[model samples]
Target chain A: MSLSDAPGPRWRPAPLLPRDEEREVSLHFVVAVLCFLACLMAVGGVSADRAARGWARDLRGEATIQVRPRLGETGDEAAARAAEAVAGVRGVTEAAALEKQKAEALLEPWLGKAVLQDLPIPHLVTVRLDRAHPATATDLKKALDRAGVDADVDDHARWLKDVERSAGVVRWAVAILFSLTAAAAAAVIAFATRAGMAARRDVVEVLHLTGAKDAFIANLFQLRFARLAAVSGVFGAGAAAAVTALIELVGGGQGFTPALPLTWMDLLTVSPCPLVAATVAALSARLTTLRLLRGTL
Target chain B: MSRQPTPRAAAAYGAEEAFDPTTGPVVRFQNVGMRYGRAPEVLKDVGFTLPVGSFHFLTGPSGAGKSSLLKLIYLANRASRGTVQLFGHDVERVARADLPYLRRRIGVVFQEYRLLDHLPAFDNVALPLRIAGRKPQTYRDDIAELLTWVGLGHKMQAMPATLSGGEKQRLAIARAVVTQPELLLADEPTGNIDPEMSLKILRLFVELNRMGTTVLIATHDQDLVGRAGMPVLHLNEGRLSRKATRRAPEPAAPDYGPELGPEYEPEPDEPELGYDLGDEEGEA
Candidate 1:
């Protein structure tokens, strides 16, 4: 850093603007908190989406059929015929007639065995659909109609619709949370820029009247706040990621809860947080500085 | 950045010759009026001209608007009314983007020695050149030479807070002249310094003036004005008039304090007063 070095040392000019240290630290804290909340929102959104899809998948894979005996056939024979028809359909992976024993088991809790034996129980069939291209309700109806078996099919479409709607709502809430966090960060940066200008008005005045360009003075605050925001963003993202990892570690395979699961891959989503924070800070600082300079001059 | 040096020519208000910078004044003010943001005018109907290489002392009491007039020269404030022409370009017509370039051609040494506290003495001195976009390698030696000339070579690395008042004043001077501006304006350059330092600053201005930079110093020190032996543009209560001659015993101007010990005196052969200051002083 001395002048006597080999080639005259490059004159690294000192920073033209100074940040009041206490306010800068407080600003860092506010921005870091916003970033952490944003990361949590992002991770929560993804997990909720996965949970909804899982519920829908379970509902889609299984369908139940209620069978009424034909005039000449017994209830068991009718149920077996229905299963055979469904098994021959294109998307049915497996189908079987529900035996009387399993049917009794399903009804025993609601009705005492003595009353169940006296009552005539309905015969039933269970069908498994291929997950990738499950059969639609219309397809199942058409197949039953072709077999001439008197039966009603229930594909759990109502439950699937409700799950999808809940997932959509979660998606919207996460987007709003993320947007609010970004806006709060921008506001903090703008406030810091204004405070910085107030703290060093004399320096700005001298630089302006001394023929320094407006861009030169503005660049000073922009770079300073940008660097600060980037560091804050790193801390925020790191803390969020670490907390998520801890949850995953404690909860084993199905993390935290089945409804909202955390996975190792979700941490990658937070990697760009620091860069986003820095960009927002730079833009906020630049606009604030230009407005102040133009207004004051 | 200043307009080319024009021929030493004179023009008065409403003069009917085609205006030419190649032959016009370095600065021309015609019926100029200035005020700060809707306030009452502080300067009114002022007119003057400084030709190339002229040095003048602007002397008045504290409320005489001396600083306001200097602001108009340095492009810190625009005239509220009338014409202000600097280096032959009408300031009103200059675009906002061009104002900084125009200011680059003029150097200002502030009353407060507005050196930034964070910068070392050398960086402070090198600011103007840096703002003008000169490379550090090109101006580094020149800065050292200028600092050495101003008695600051040994303190080049010292922060501004560490320097004494006189040292700060001289450091401010070095910053102002690092770019070798065509015009130099100083506001109360001697107020906070000792008498010896005051004389040293006066000599620096004289030397800068000799090097063809037009110089204007606003001060309350009667001794500095008398010792420099330059024409005085006396401003009083929003009005301006020139003394035009330096012969001592200025009847038209305010009393130069009898305390200005025997260094300057009235000359018997000098006329009563050369300025058209009229019967106001006659009554006095």
Candidate 2:
């Protein structure tokens, strides 16, 4: 007797690829860890980048001058005169003479206390420039010459350039690190896809002989891996965000020391981790599957 | 060096909508040979023609290259040398993009009964339609009815892993005919089933052939081949030798369908829909 008389509830096609493979779980863990590392790198890269910019900004707005004594004057008198000369110049926000004690304190970190008293010190003048229209070295020098002060006006141009260069290096390093992590994630996904295809040759062979296009077969793997990577991305991104939050919470007002200032906004950047992971997985799986089909199926 | 596209290929590519190719033999092989990468040829100097809608049994010993021959017909593997033509288009010369178009017209049942283990019997049978880009609702009833017709109606929701050897074989058969392809090729299709089910499966192929679907079965069952009384293309040691069939010869097939090759005869472009041929009436 025939048994198909009454059709059951509306039927839907099951997943083309098996869902409960043990390797898939392993793949998820590996991909999720990669995503977590990538997310952390992203956070660190941005924080370090911001810190570098802040240091460069500080250097750009300041200048220091070393004042030498004239035949009739003491070092202190010459330094005060130099400071007054610089303060009158255009774009000079403020200028002040540095006391010997303050200068010795600044040098204490590098030079030991034993050599400090015996050495003849040149009086110093500190200058703060208008950030929008900062005074140049030439302007400061012209003022010093006009005031008849024997001084070497250092506009901090050399230090500022070095700081800017360091910032550029940090930017590029972060960029390269980010790219390598993404590439690693993609390679891992490609490897997993290859193994998955090999394990399911029966399914692939049947689909191929049944007139499925290479794209049709590839799409199955692409979607499967993409979903796996997306969930992995979520866990990774969430962990990264939590770590960032904890550092920000315990990191005083400046965050994990003044060097890396982690703000709450950094958490928002990791939100796209899941999306990026999905994209990479989808692309890697599709390419691997098409290549396999072309070469074998 | 330059390459020239044949008139049929040009028509197939340029004016697909209006290109109704003139049909002759459904399959033609001339001095065909096949081999794996740098390996010796498994099929050598094979030559034959399968007229449209003709039924034949390809009987051979274990390493006789029966599966390899079907592989050439289905576009799974290319012929090493000489010509293998299908629907009047040369298999080797056809563009890669157009291979799927040709493959859609041919259905295969492997000796392994290569059903997707992840899918239920109903979805497994519905695979060809889904691959052809049909919606679920349109083919839902037909697929349910097809599963019922294959004695798998009650097993529609069951996975291939949960089924017995014979049940899986029947499910494979239902999937093979779901598209009602122009040509059906089987490699020991009844290898896993009982004699009764084997006869029933043979009857299924016979009925499909009568409806203008060409059939080629690769089998070791001499009794089934004898009972069917179809012409036998006997293969031994990578060579083919033909045997006369007891049944009267039918006329050559009419003109081949458009899109290169779909239905040899365009009656419904569908299967024996709800034909109630589920129970065997001793057609084999």
Candidate 3:
């Protein structure tokens, strides 16, 4: 008879961490996974929110100043006229020539405060428009050309677009990573349960012959694995939470750091990770048992 | 159930008087053949009808497919060739999900005793009842009484790995009969036990049969088969040869009898089931 015809006993391999092994990890692993997921979800939400809010603020209160040179006027003279004309424009809230000092302050965070003291900075104007939405840079530039100004608009829309798209990419990437990890965890647990079943094959065969149904046999392993996955999940999530908490605590004490801070909402998002881990365990155990039983006893 | 060629041939072969004439048989195998994957035929053109409540011995040497035949009866393996009707139902055509329900109606004892080492004697004996979804409170008294009858009243809590050879055999028997199965299939149950224990177990089998449970035992013990006086379904090299008018041997053991005292001793730690007969008055 072929090997398939005389199918081996309905036993699969045991999990890497059997019940008698270091069971603590298995128990806590589920919770730990939840924590990790919660953190990732929270951070993504917060980062996206912050970027979007910053873009909204810039869009609401900002305007562009442009200059166009008349046939004989110097670029400097045109720049001066554009600034003066912007200052005179109706409903212009605060039209200040953007000083080298203010520009240097923006660069201070990146290039250090002292580096800008020796450099020649660009001459620009910062305008707070009173209208509901900012005017398009193109419209503002055309208006400035009619006014004999030789400068162009800078509304920072392109910069905002880049920021928003990058945040979106990160959110999607995190989602993909979460799904893949959960699948991997399921695969690992399934294989382990299969092995455990194989090792205890005689037990299964005897049970079957003596009237144990396949469901009853499968239920036993399912419960055990779900319990194990829950524990492991808790451990993994707890570890992640602790690490994130430490980083946040350190950053908070060091000053207004540029790093993303963990909010209660972020931590809360990962709360379901443990439950998902348990689900993974149960699904893996169930699928493995079903497949193996189908092939064997 | 139609006029199949194989079944007709098998019935005409050597099983004419193999079945009992008193009542309908519990298991009827007509032209059964089984083969493992791609292997040459193991059991071929086999047919036997085990009458209800009849005690019979199936004799064959090692690897003569004795276990394979028993497997078919127990629904462990399906026949590749013909029909096996169990408890009046065609097994080959039955639904796979229906096997568990049918299996609960049968009991089996393996050559190795196949006891779960982790569970104690009580749990092992109670397994069949448990699998049938009997509540612990519902079947507790029945299981207790059966264990006591099997002379394992005191060893209920003892693990199989620690039990003596004879004790293990009795435990296996108790588990098999706990559910009051309609049919019992034993493979070399007496192979590892002492002659005295063998006779005791044989008497147990006869008692079960008399209680309306059909029993089929596969053994190489000539004397045990002769003592039972049951028809011998002799199998050799995949061919069955029926022995005509097999005679019953004398009840008493002859020269090779181990000098076990006639008196039954109650081991000190044995729990009291209150059946302390001084000795077996006579051999069966």
Of the candidates shown, which would achieve the greatest DockQ relative to the real structure?
Answer: 2
Question: Comparing candidate 1 with candidate 3, which one achieves the higher TM-score?
Answer: 1
lDDT of 3 by residue, A135-245 (tens): 556656666667766677787777767766776776677777767777777877787688778877777788788877778778777887787777666666666666656
Worst 10-residue lDDT window, candidate 1 chain A? A1-10
In model 2, the runs with Cα more than 4 Å from the true position are A1-10, A108-115, B1-23, B36-41, B247-284
Candidate 2 docks at the CAPRI level of acceptable
Model 1, range A1-297, lDDT digits (tens) per residue? 223311245765566775578988898899999889888888888888888888889899989899999899999999999998888887889989999999999999999889997989989899999998888767877888999989999898888899999989999999998988999999999998998888898888888888877888889889998999999999999988988888889989778899998789988878888999999999999999998888743
Residue B147, model 3, lDDT: 71
Off by over 4 Å in 1: A1-8, A57-64, A69-77, A96-126, B1-24, B243-284
> For model 3, how does the per-residue alpha-carbon lDDT over B75-131 read when each residue is reduced to its tens digit?
888888977877666776555555676688789998788888777777777777777
The 10-residue segment of model 1 chain B with minimum total lDDT is B275-284
Tens digits of per-residue lDDT for model 1 on B153-214?
Answer: 77888999999998999999889887778889999888878876677667677777667677
- Candidate 1's clash total is 1
Order the candidates by TM-score, highest first.
2, 1, 3
Could you tell me every candidate's TM-score relative to the true structure? 0.84, 0.86, 0.74
Measured against the native two-chain assembly using Cα atoms, what DockQ does each of the candidate structures obtain, in the order listed? 0.28, 0.39, 0.18
Best by lDDT: 2
User: Residue A46 CA error for candidate 3 (Å)?
Assistant: 6.5
